[model samples]
Target: MRPPCHAVLPVIACALGALFHATQAAAALKPAQLAIVINDADPDSVAMGEYYRKRRGIPATNVVHVSIPGKPRSIGVAQFRLLKQAIDSKLGPSIQAVLMVWTAPYAVQCNAITAAYTLGYDARQCAHTCAAGQPSAYFNSASKRPYTDHGLRPSMLLPTALPPIAGPPASLAPEQARQGAQALVERGVAAGARSLPASAYYLATSEVARNSRAGFFPPAGHLPAHRLTIRRMTADVLEGAHDVLVYQTGMAQVAKLETLAFVPGALADHLTSHGGDLLGSSQMSSLRWLAAGATASYGTVSEPCNHWQKFPNSAVLLRRYLGGDSAIEAYWKSVAWPAQGLFIGEPLAAPYAVASN
Candidate 1:
């Protein structure tokens, strides 16, 4: 028995625990199907693009070159529209996923640029930060080709600056960004095409408001087929885990991350209002997950009022990832309403691709 779904909107909250039992073999995303967008003006972006292209063997045709002013952290709708047009026109018809290379301009108006690009600009998100912004077609869907099947591209950010530089000279920022990006790309490329044995941590934090995602946590056990162990516990911060694959918890400021070790192609994130503010978020930035050795993470750019729909639903994400969907697919599919959230990481990381039935 399930609640009635709205005619125009899909039912988001449903019992789909059985979804984890089956893998979507058709949902495997390939490197050629992904398009990497680079800001030619930004040398760091260009350098990271080339490095990722070579490492992932992404075709030159799939590399998109655009010239956009990379200064503002959030650009107006007008400027974003123009920039999106330039990149969209060249994406052609086969690109299913997009990788944006740059740090600034992660948000357009109030919506995350990654969400705005895939779902189109949501004027409503800017109008009310706490209101339901926009419904996504790819949310929890079994669609393999988001662009071809759903007519919408799924995008993630491969920022030039992953673990952002703090108290560093302006001249050293680009070099440091290049090194960080190179490390991120290497981690992603190394996490895939095989079965992996890893642990998924779901912590019930003391912050009641931030723990909206607690209900969505999957049971704690070992699924030998996928080589995954799901663990549920009540703790504020995780410590001394050597094989961390999924670390999803709610906290304004996550502490003691250095105490744990994250596996390659790992997915980790904290639930908070400003985690998506990549540059100067008051809370811990999503970038910290990457710095802590996780391959991908998500965070909301604006105030979302702790709506579970605005954050990644762990059940859906775990199912999709175990089902052979890439990092971008699983992360993007988990969020019911993603207009306010930002997806950042290597889009192609799929450590469990070989385990799917």
Candidate 2:
């Protein structure tokens, strides 16, 4: 006989571990029938989901992992077929979000066809194109250098008179990484020390939210590329909800250093079109809003992630400003790396709030 669903319950429980926390008193998050489509069986994605499920006390059954066709590196038509099948089988009207892990050619296809056309997170591709077949930067220094047909490479710091760059190289020596970091700090300071953008800050927050204990810091350079991805993904997700809150956290110094780049005007415009507001909350220091878009209201939250032991109380101010859940802080603290003292967690809890909206 096939194993009963409850048989897997223990395994799921073990996998979930310290991550799950129960929510009884607060307003319930409207369930979003979320569907997670993965490129392959990766430890990172699996660990990430487990963290979210247990941290939020979402039932094990609520998180489904669907495997795609093809090798882990290449996401071609076969991979697309599996992804489409997974979505067609599981996605219903109640589903609010679909997160795809890893980059694939089909990822662009899926985002364009499903996220853009079907989910209404549409976008116009920018014309500032990199040369075709120039080569891919699987691993290169933060310098804004052209690429060649190199298979895989190490990261190196370029000389001055160049923009800084960042991102983990597939295989970078420690000395190389150190030099790169130094170069980035110098170049970043010289560039009038511009802040990246609200979206970039949000992405950093997500990484912090997901793996704060991992000691992950944004690489020295590559701020523009980071900003582009964060803006696109957050904008897409926010468009589907009536209100979305993003929490940006860092060391007081780094947070202060990057504050100038959080462009409220650009993010506000994106938010306003979706009938949403973009609020930045920090735990360490303050973030200055450089600009505001026409439709959305842009501002900051005063607290940081470590104070979440007081989640119920801090959220009082958040509800006053954005009008969402109070229990979210409690829920986040129970499961997340609260000791790390990163960003706020309301936006992470937004799915629960904006479900009916």
lDDT of 1 by residue, 76-167 (tens): 89988888898888988888889998877789878999999989899877888998657787888888888888999999998787554232
Per residue, candidate 2 scores C-alpha lDDT tens digits across 30-113 of: 323333443345443454445444443444544556654432322334545565566546544444334343222222221222
Q: Which stretches of candidate 1 lie above 4 Å from their native place? A: 1-13, 24-27, 164-174, 193-196, 355-357
Candidate 1 steric clashes: 0
Model 1 TM: 0.92
Indicate which candidate wins on lDDT. Answer: 1
* Global lDDT of each candidate: 0.83, 0.25
* Residue range with the least summed lDDT across 10 consecutive positions in model 1: 1-10
Using all chains and alpha carbons, the TM-scores for the candidates as numbered come to 0.92, 0.31
RMSD of 2: 22.2
